[model samples]
Target: MGLYHFAKSLVYGLLKPVYRMEVIGTENFPKDGGVLLCSNHIDNLDPPMVGITAPRTIHFMAKEELFEVPVLGKILPNINAFPVKRGMSDREALRKGLKVLKEGNVLGLFPEGTRSKSGELGKGMAGAGFFALRSDAYVVPCAIIGPYKAFTKLKVVYGQPIDMGPIRERKASAEETTELIMAEIGKLIEVHR
Candidate 1:
């Protein structure tokens, strides 16, 4: 926990002023315990934006390519970030997410996997929902409303936490649960456009 905060302070101090961030619904973030945060992907800055906004460490499932890089790899893992293969099942990534929750760290996921080229949120892959179910982590739907214009003021609106117990307990198919997860995220982000 000490290492987590140390890294967060270092990174966030440098980036927050540079981005000139504006975060909304910060009150929606939990102060203690583990959580699964699901958000739309837009900018590469998205993860750190979410990190500085939260009072806790938010570990993202990063791309394997990031690890191959020299500096980001070292800094990212220290901040609790791990890599996932681009197109495969990526069970190792999922297992790491499960471990994150087990160890009481906040896990961040972008259902779309990669950033959208169209400047819009694409159909979510639903793997995020399955992980939430498996870990029994409370899903917090988030919307990153426009750093489409980068140095400008951006809005990150987070909504109330979604209860996953009923669907998870029902042992529903991955498809059904994914729909619910996406639908809930859509609702929270409805006004972003």
Candidate 2:
């Protein structure tokens, strides 16, 4: 098996015993083609949780600081994790994200840009929308309900793909598209709140 697949399998196995993980709306995922998985960021585990739970091998746009770590810098790239410089419009990271999608890979992103300290979904940044429009990939809204505690039930629900008509038609700005996508993510997780 490929490195990504092998790692995903190993992590999934570990998560199974640690959290009562439930994945919903699995059919909503595109069988192929570029896909942008937009999710809310609650904590650090959010990315890995979505990665292992999703139906496809998903890549992530992690913070650039993570890649600065000695060993992690070497390992992240091999596992499909790329660095994104937060707090600014990093063109290089955006380019990498577009490339991954163009190659028909799943690119996992959290529109919020950072984790919410209150566990409440906050305003989203424009990065997710930018990538969505640039790549013309399917935008899948995902909500993660738990893993707040070990051995606790955690639910992840994938909502229907967002219709990117406004984005496609250039009728909406990146900020506006981001708001719309974040709204969908919020709705998906409302049930668990």
Candidate 3:
């Protein structure tokens, strides 16, 4: 196993029982090629929860602040996570995300940009759509619910890959494309709930 997979499995083995985690529709994940795992943000747990359960290694873009921590700084990149500046158009970060996709690796993105304080889905940022458009990669909508506390059931639902052909052909606005992605994510959340 790769370092990323090994780390995910080890962490997952420990946390699975604590959260009573269940992963649904993992079959929906494409077996190959570049794809985007667009999901809603809830807390710091969301990334690891989805990453460990995903069938493939997922490269994520975490907030730059998290990388400032001494230990996390060294660990996050080792696990395929890179830093991105939140609330701004960080070109370098976007370039990195595109590079991952171009290399035919899975890229995980929390379309909402940051964790939801209310634990409810928030509006998506344009990054997911932008990457999908530029890379011509399939977009998979994933929903992670519950897991708000210890002993609670944490469910992750992987929805079917969203076809962005029409949107890409028409050259849709980033806002419009993001709404569609968020809509798909919302549907997955409702299904898992």
Which candidate number would show the highest lDDT if scored against the true structure? 3
lDDT for 68 in candidate 2 is 89
Tens digits of per-residue lDDT for model 2, 44-109: 888878988899988899999999899879989999999999999899999999999999999999
Per-residue C-alpha lDDT of model 1 across residues 70-174, encoded as one tens digit per residue: 887787787788999977888888888889887777899888888987657688876777777788566788888775463677777787788787887888876
User: In angstroms, how far off is 116's CA in candidate 3?
Assistant: 0.8
* Candidate 1 wrongly placed segments (more than 4 Å): 1-3, 18-20, 148-151
Of candidates 3 and 2, the better by TM-score: 3
Which runs in model 3 stand beyond 4 Å of their true positions? none
Clashing pairs in 3: none
Clashes in each model (backbone N, CA, C under 3 Å)? 0, 0, 0
Between candidates 2 and 3, the one scoring higher on lDDT is 3
TM-score comparison, 1 vs 3, better candidate: 3
lDDT of each structure?
A: 0.78, 0.89, 0.90
| Candidate 2 TM-score to native | 0.95
Q: How far off is residue 79 in model 2, in Å?
A: 0.8
Judge candidate 2 against the unseen true structure and give its global Cα lDDT, from 0 to 1.
0.89
lDDT of 2 at 162: 94
| Best candidate according to TM-score | 3
lDDT, candidate 3, equals: 0.90
